[model samples]
Target chain A: MLSPKRTKYRKAHKGRIHGLSTSGTTLNFGQFGLNALQPERITARQIEAARRAITRHMKRQGRLWIRIFPDVPVSVKAAETRMGSGKGSPEFWVARVHPGRIIFEIDGVSDTIAHEAFALAAAKLPINVKVVARQGEGA
Target chain B: MANAIKLAATARDRAGKGVARETRRQGRIPCVIYGAGQAPVMISVDAAAVARDVHASNFVTKTYDIDVGGVSHHVLPRDVQFHPVSDRAIHIDFLRIDAASLINVSVPFEFKNAETSPGLKRGGALNIVHHEIEVRCRPDQIPAHITIDLAGLEINASVHLSGVSFPEGVVPHVSEKDFTIATIATPSALRGKEDGEGDGAASPAEAAKA
Candidate 1:
């Protein structure tokens, strides 16, 4: 659903998501966050679904930042076609989320409210999630 | 600061997704050099080179002499935006710098003499509080890394910023308070285990979690 308008002709090999992330490990602009505990390719559709769930819970109260963007082109062969032809054209887009990557963050709301919001969002994903608060300053 | 490294680029006429995609197609990263009271200039540099420079350990502290067309402009890399999924350098932002002006930068912390510390000799781990510190220094005075020696530190001892000697004319941005840089901390559970008692069981809470 979030395919880039133009892309390179050749396909790209799937790369490994290893080690802890450096930047997204901290909450830059949010109170509560959803940190990915496992490395997985989060589909664009899943990101959209999680964002919708978060905003729906917030109901326009707080700010939300989606740190990762779905830019990887995921190619899939047709369901019923016979195998062993050529690589399938780019099917959709996905974001490779690694451990410690903050998938979602929310601010401008109470701790319980943000916690509840991210919980609703996390239920839509396919990886283990940890809800963390911003470090230092105050609770 | 280390001498500014040379970077080669060309001025671009347009700035947009269309142009950026086209630039990436040619294996060059689209970038903008601004922030010196002059209008922003769009340019493109070798994507592979950008990737290499960005991965350098001291990328943030180093200055660069970016050659835009035939003219060279001294600049610092302010930001490098990578494609989220592919994790490749897609855009770079450079800020023009004057060699004489005082600028703020975060320099990585380098600790020394951990081997001689009494705490470390007793199986304590060095817990770093700040991996890097923000300091205001001239473009020429930025230290590659701030070094702190823990030669005489004991268990639970911490070295504050005031204890370390920064290069002359380099002042910390957090001068209002003496902040901690690192500490020699013993894992409390391991501390209990090393108490000479044969019993070294996990605490109740830790056991429950396990």
Candidate 2:
């Protein structure tokens, strides 16, 4: 659902996602968040689902900040067609979930509530994640 | 020391998420400058200029003369908010300062005379502990980067904050403790190799005895 209005070029280079990730290591916005342990392409639908889970758990009381945004365009080919011609049509937009990147952050709620809400949100994602709290919040 | 740069800006009065978003849409960076016994002044500057300045080495230390609608304001960048996906600078906060302002700023380190160090010549690695030292100084008196002379350092030798020269009128904020800046250490890989050789020599004699 979230795609860039314009791009320099249609397709991007296959970037190397391997090696240790360096960004998104620190908690920035919210009190609690989910840190990506493995690289993934998180879809907009998955993010929406995660958002719904958090909103449902919090009962619209606290703020939920989605750290990642679905901006990278992922193209797709027809399933039953031949594997020739040009690159496939733009299928969906995805947020590249590199390791150490915060996926979601929530604040203004109790620790127990934040934990359960993040747990529910984490289930919708595909990559390995660890729930992290704001430094000095608990320990 | 890095030269102080000038940035063009427009003064804004309103403050909110919608306002910030609108500023971004107009290709500008929304910012607020407060402190120094004055009320907060909201403004916006060219996003590209802020991005370029943010990438400079002295981004956190250098003084910026932001020209907002013909009025000039000397300030230091306090924070920069980037777009989540694009990693572009969207918003920023600049703290207003003056010649009389003795604000605390972190000045990063610049290792000097590394080639002259005997320990470094023998494959010793410099382990930096404090990347920067917070100092209370005027905006014009802020040092771009503090240099640590490693000429006299040997392996296992530590350089404390007192060893580096502080700029005139720039006093370190930490008067309580003499913190270490960096240390010359033996490389772990070399140490491991030397330890393996010592163990191998001892094992041969022990094996012969057995």
Candidate 3:
């Protein structure tokens, strides 16, 4: 099994299954929706709101967690190298937005709870919990 | 059998590495459409448009309504070519899927549940052994993904290829008992506890009996 860290590293330095550049991009292929996730509609306020909601949800859910919201200085390099990726932000400009499109990554949980959490988020926010890519040992 | 996506395409009169590079420079991707008992034909497509659709999960099976030299054809992705350096699609292979023909394709796995699983809650990590599995099905009955609800799976439990249920008229080519698709074990800090406890109890019991 591939760890999320190894997977990201493989995607960055080695190559990715989607065949897209990892120079700055995270996901290259797989099922994703752009229905309302167009780049133009994102706003700083909405990102902040989503960040707060997700962070609170993670804390309330009772687990060690990390958050990566849009315009939070989350570089592909940082994601490929660092475990937490980066930090939170409230004043960064909105890089992109779609009403319900988001990337939610949860670790150290069961499939059932993960799914439920994903469903809950999807229902509450304009985002989709596409898939989970876990890391290997020490990842 | 749900929504079938269609896109316009064109057959290329010129073929070769140079032609392909030129096509890319013009914001087009080189592609090929074969199968249906016909010879392989080279083609090109709008790079941006295909990229958006390719980002979707079931890229290959989705019917692309392509127009090649004003001729319309329904196609599915078969193979992809990427730039060695850029990793962007340089060439694509689309097969003209026949309604009656059974084709082999790899479908994605969508795992559900994370926040509520006992294993995950206890710090056990979920590791997907297979991201996609190959199955035989008609073009129209192609499933977008092989969704598995990981609602109550314990740590070390797996969802194998045999466990995957397909849509009507779809069947996995893998024989019974074949160990295919799966989400298996990735021991972490949590597993250490189990290992410690298991060894401690077993060793003490064996020593006392001796």
Candidate 4:
């Protein structure tokens, strides 16, 4: 799983994703990309699962880039805990992904392989996604 | 010089988000033609036609003869905005140009002789720094696409802008530094093996296990 090695704060507030992403919306390093269609908090485990799906489908032939990182620490309270206590310890990391963000990018793969790989990866994600191609590169 | 693609367009009376949406509902894309010191003309072109051209190679550098109602305007595709979810062409900007117009355009790079490159044969990845290079040239002299020959490039070798030969009268927009366009990068699997040989350092997986 992908997580930050160091941080200034141990835990972060649960932020709301309001609008479409302003950046990382285009395919920068690859011919095909997986674009998010809804806002969600993607955990590190989900990202790893999606990455494994993509790489396994591609047979590790092409290169893959994870555009988003799990930097926001998500804290959780223990079961049956009282409400008067303080915030719980950091449990896991997540990335706040807004709509229209390119979550994954792949290169050096055929059109059929890229689409199939993205389809396999999308099943592991919580949000709706679409396969996108670089302009003038794929159908 | 490449031949101009002819497209039929109609002059539009309004310009706004609502009007653009309405045009899209009618299976037409809202486009504006401006530049060359002339007033901007709002027009609507067939959505399917614009989508086809947008997906074609060298869309920005390609010249277009858009026939607006009756008047034909010589223009170049300045920009294209796509719908976020559907990946459809929502809006397009066309810059009017003439024979003497000096325009700056980003030309796509078409790599050649990749099989002949020693680096590529060794399973090295061609890391492209710039998919397109901005160049200033006349509308008539704009190259379709810049050819990058990777015939004898070796592992770790880089192709710089200064080493590329552009067509006559076509000059790179950036001249201050010799910017690297692409490089033959060593594969991560090979890099790990080389690092282990140089220093007896354990790989990430081995370190994690420890």
Name the lDDT of candidate 4.
Answer: 0.84
iRMSD (Å) of candidate 3?
A: 16.3
* Per-residue accuracy of model 2 over B83-132 as CA lDDT, tens digit each: 53344677778888777867898776777898899987776656666666
Q: Identify the candidate with maximal DockQ.
A: 4
Weakest lDDT window of 10 consecutive positions for candidate 1 chain A: A130-139
DockQ of each: 0.03, 0.02, 0.03, 0.34
My TM-score estimates for the predictions, one after another, are 0.58, 0.56, 0.55, 0.88
Q: What global local distance difference test value does model 3 have?
A: 0.54
Could you give candidate 3's per-residue lDDT for residues B1-210 as a string of tens digits?
Answer: 555565666778888889888889999999888888888888888898877555455676577777777777778888776443334677888888777888898777667776666765664555555666778988888877777777777777777766767778888765556574544344434333555422211222233454
Which candidate achieves the best TM-score against the true structure?
Answer: 4
TM-score of decoy 4? 0.88
lDDT of 3 by residue, A34-77 (tens): 12222232334443343344334433332222222233222243
- Candidate 4, B1-210: lDDT as tens digits: 767889999999987899889899999999999998999999999988767778665888889999987899999999998776677888899999998878999998888999999988887777888889999999999998889999999989999988899999999997559989999876545665644432221222234554
Rank by DockQ (best first): 4, 3, 1, 2
Name the TM-score of candidate 1: 0.58
* Of candidates 4 and 2, the better by DockQ: 4
The CAPRI-style docking tier of model 1 reads incorrect
Candidate with the larger DockQ of 1 and 2: 1
Q: TM-score of chain B, candidate 3?
A: 0.83
Model 2 ranges off by over 4 Å = A1-139, B1-4, B82-86, B194-210
